[model samples]
Target chain A: MKVRSHRAGKLLKGLWLALVLAFLYIPIIVMIALSFNASVSRAAWTGFTLDWYVKLFKSKQIMAALNVTITVAVIATVVSTVLGTLGAIGMHAMSTGMANLLINVSYLPMTTPDIVTGVSLMLMFIFVKVPLGKWTMIMAHIAFDTPYVLFSVMPKLRQMNPNLYEAALDLGCHPAKALYKVIIPEIMPGIVTGALLAFTMSLDDFVISYFTSNTDQNLAMIVYSAARRGVEPTMYALSTLMFIVVLGLLLIVNRRNGLEDIA
Target chain B: MKRSWYAAPYGVWMVLFTVVPLLFVLYYAFTDQSGAFTVNNFVKIASPMYGLVLWDSLRLAFFCTLLCLLIGYPTAYFLASRDFSNAQTLVVLILVPMWMNFLLRTYAMMTLFENNGVINTLLESLGLERIQMIGTEGAVLVGMVYNFLPFMVLPVYTVLKKMDYSVIEAAEDLGASPIRVVSRVVLPMSIPGVVSGITMVFMPAVTTFAISRMLSSGMIYLVGDMIEDYFIAMNNRNVGSTISLVMLVLIILSIGLLRKVDPDNTGGGLW
Candidate 1:
């Protein structure tokens, strides 16, 4: 009786996992299936066709939004990576009290709700008479993304040997040279991870990007406006393609670093 | 000492972008249209109309967090269990959907829940009447659970994965039933993860503008949607900033609670 009960318990756990997986994936799978439906109406599938994919690529609005999204994400990632890495290094060299203060201050952006961040940034831009546009959007992305980079790099800095930099300096290396040759390489994994994380966050961000941009619509804003109006087959197609890219990138990152570090 | 100065540019940037902008929120929250300081914005939020919205947001977020915890606790347990041969692969599966664009995933839920959408169509073909799924509170709750479930699962899984299995073995060897082993031993050890998971799921679920907007077809209004409309649609930054300030306080309080529970910064640091 005890052995049977244990087996039943195992079966129940397996069933729960399956049920949850179904709950998570069914909506996504249904959406992906509808992207190939010949009719735009989600209810009726007259036949399967690739026309949505063709139209997705042909749509000027979507293409333009894609261009803007990539541009903003890349720029934000680059700027935040440089600034955050420097900041992390600088904080590492600080007194413990100073470093803790800086770290807590940095948590402000990460901890605050995205809408609050978005609205505050929007108000600030108007207060300073700066127009809401791609640049403001990029700036907001950098504000949120920098802390993540700083966090990712800080862990690596903690793990590095303190003697390595001193040894490089004692061997007659310039301070900057030691930083470049020894310190940077020691933290390269963290830097790369941080940059990738920044890019992903910038790409996926909608709320902050929505408030901070006026004329420039990224892919998320485009999808928001389009989804609000109604469902479009071409939008589904675009999402599938984007989903594929995200899945591939995550798989690569997972294989490389186990993905536990980032999450 | 020289190296510490390297953060000078970053410090300046943070002050300009992070510190100054938040001060702008505080300023706008207290001021009226003429930019003079006033408490009327807070007075406006105190009225029943906005008060109900706040109450509804709290209710929805609470349930969303509860449902996530219920669904996520077992999911995390199974994923973290040594009995599962492919736990790593399952973990990756959970994360892949999470990495997808936030809006796109919410939008995808609409396809399933629309009146003429997939579920209703299947029901119709079976000679059943179509049920109204969109523009309802339930739809919004489902959207919240769907989007934020991963947040709950990941943190709990992280804690459980690092948990020592020998304790469970010792409990079993000492004649403790499976129920007692989990209830007494497993549950106690997983509190930090559960707390972290609750924070992760609750915060985003509370402040989500997009999920409510897309899933409810604009019928439901959460705090996030309220802020968006005040600032964007109504052109009332004062009221919006006031609401945002309230949200910031809620966020700070929760983080404080989480820190008290998990002081060592485990469960992956809340971001």
Candidate 2:
């Protein structure tokens, strides 16, 4: 009786998880499905159509917004990855207390509300006030993204064998040579993961970009302004494309590492 | 020859950019128009309208946190408890939405909730009429849960994963029933994650201007909306700065209290 019931419980648990997974995914599936539906009305499927996707290519404003978002994300990610990795290495080299303090201070910006971050950055711009534009957006992204990259890289840094660097130095290698040849190679995985995270984060941002962004628009901000009247077909097309890009990138990274998920 | 040249450019960048700007925001938050530092800006929080904004913030945060807990807790437990090799893929799949554009996600939801949208049309077909799910306070809550569910789930899963299965095995061997074991042991062990998830969900729900705007159609004024209106639309920076300070204080206090209550939160482990 006990064994039978245990088996039953296990079956129940599996079913429950399956159901939960379905619930988690169905909404996104609905969005993707509707984006492809030939019929405009989600109420009834009229037929199959690629016009929505095609229409997206014809829109200049959307193309501009897409360009802006991509550029900002690319710049922000590259800058943050370098700063953050170095910051992580610096923390690793430091004593424990200072390292902890620096790490904590660096991550504080991430915890604050986007509104606070946006307004604060905007005010900062206004005070000394450079023009709020692409650069300001990059500035804000770096401010927050550094900590994320640091945290991602720190564990891998800690995991690395210190003697490799020491051995290189003992062999008469320069400090730069030791760092570039030894320390950086060990921490590449962490750095890459952090860069990916930063890229997605900068791409998905709204409130900060909304405030600090000059007359330009990112994908998210454009969707916001367009959704004001009604969701444009192009918004669906663009989001679907972005969703595909995100999935494809993650899959590529996962496949390269041969890991199903980041642990 | 320069220690400053290449040793820490990010530090220089942050100092010139982030740190300097942050201090200026703090200065603005404290000072009045005449350059005199006063608590009057902070005192403006006592106004009834701002008071309502605070209340609205708390209500939204509390409910959104609760809703996420209701959905995410079960989902997380299921994910954590599973031993199947394929489960990690499903977990990752669930989290993929976390990377999607916030505005696009909101737009997708708007399609489902709008008057001529999916949910209503289905309801009408089912002989239900005028459900009023959109443009109400409920729509805002739905929007929030839709966005923040993964945030809550991920943290809770972290906790659930850390919990020792041996505790459950021991409890069962001691003759406690399954439900009893879960309530008495599993639930207790997950409090730290619960606190973290609640704060993660609550902070955004309270501060979010986008969902409230997109779903509620500006008819449902949230505290975040009010703050935006003051600073951006109305140019009432004095009052806006005051409210932001007040909110920062409240968040700090709440987080402190939450951390204090959760005995295991002191561990510097990130989920």
Best of the candidates, TM-score: 1
Candidate 1 DockQ, CA atoms: 0.78
The C-alpha lDDT values of all candidates are 0.88, 0.77
Q: Categorize the docking of model 2.
A: medium
Question: What ranges in model 2 sit over 4 Å off?
Answer: A1-15, A253-263, B1-7, B15-17, B33-38, B82-85, B266-271
Q: Pick the candidate with the highest lDDT.
A: 1
Deviation from native of the Cα of residue B215 in model 2, angstroms: 0.9
Could you give candidate 1's per-residue lDDT for residues A8-115 as a string of tens digits? 878898899889888889888888998999998998979999999999889899889999899999999999999999999999999999888888879888777888
Which pairs clash (backbone N, Cα, C closer than 3 Å) in model 2?
A125-A129
- Residue A108 shift from truth in candidate 2, angstroms: 0.8
Top-scoring candidate (DockQ): 1
lDDT of 2 by residue, B15-117 (tens): 6655666676678778887767877876777889778878987998898999888888877887887545676776687777776766777778888888888
